[model samples]
Target: MENISLVIMEKEKDTGFLSRELGSYEVKYDTEYVSSIYASREDENLYVNMYLTVPGEFEDWKYNAILDNYDTGLYKDKALLAEEDEDSYNPGWVIKFLFLENDNEMEEKINELLGIHVSELERVLSQLKNIEDEYRD
Candidate 1:
């Protein structure tokens, strides 16, 4: 079993458009990542965000490769074209909801957002944790 933490927040009923309106939501924060899952029935959309931690030592090629694999279409064109600067790279990504028709759909979307699988994410996170633990030794 992989080590992970999942907290399901409150169920927010009809509260208007999530993008334009502020609805009941929860934010999960940590040193490596900060995620927010918004469940707005009115808009029938669940917004997802997983801000990744980019190591300062990561080079331009490696960073661009990650973005290239993750972003779709013109969604990341600007970042792709941007010059390589240690101060300019944004490490976060946006994962729009696939289907928000029901609770099960939302769960599935959460598990498989960002064009990355849940198992892959867990494995990567576990490896990162192990590396950090070793650094402290």
Candidate 2:
């Protein structure tokens, strides 16, 4: 497995009068492929949104397959499949993980989420590679 490194590209702290949001950060994964993360905190909860832009066009069946395979068991509750937008410029899937602000194992939970993200990303890339190999054959 490749070492996963995250770099914060942008950050913002909310100072609104009645807002519960603490801050938000845009993170980029230092990997061969393009991947990014957006994290925000609202009150006692933190939401981490991970996105991997597909190399080419997006396929509905591939999206469904990824959701079926990864979005289950322990990840079922914490990780959710974000809705797709037809009008959006970028075509990719997003998996959102929720964490409690005061949780004692917050770091561990975040690490777990990162692991899942990397695993799922590898799965997607493998499938694409297989398709390319088949075409070459």
Most accurate candidate by TM-score: 2
Q: What TM-score would every model get versus the actual structure?
A: 0.36, 0.42
lDDT of 1 by residue, 1-137 (tens): 34344443334454443343322222222223423334333354444333333334444444444443432332232222211223335444543333344555544434433224333334444455345533344
Compared with the true structure, model 1 gives a TM-score of 0.36
Query: Where is model 2 poorest over a 10-residue stretch in terms of lDDT?
Result: 16-25
Model 1, C-alpha of 68: deviation from truth (Å) = 3.0
Candidate 1: 10-residue stretch with minimal lDDT: 77-86
Name the regions of candidate 1 deviating beyond 4 angstroms: 3-5, 8-35, 39-57, 71-90, 98-101, 114-137
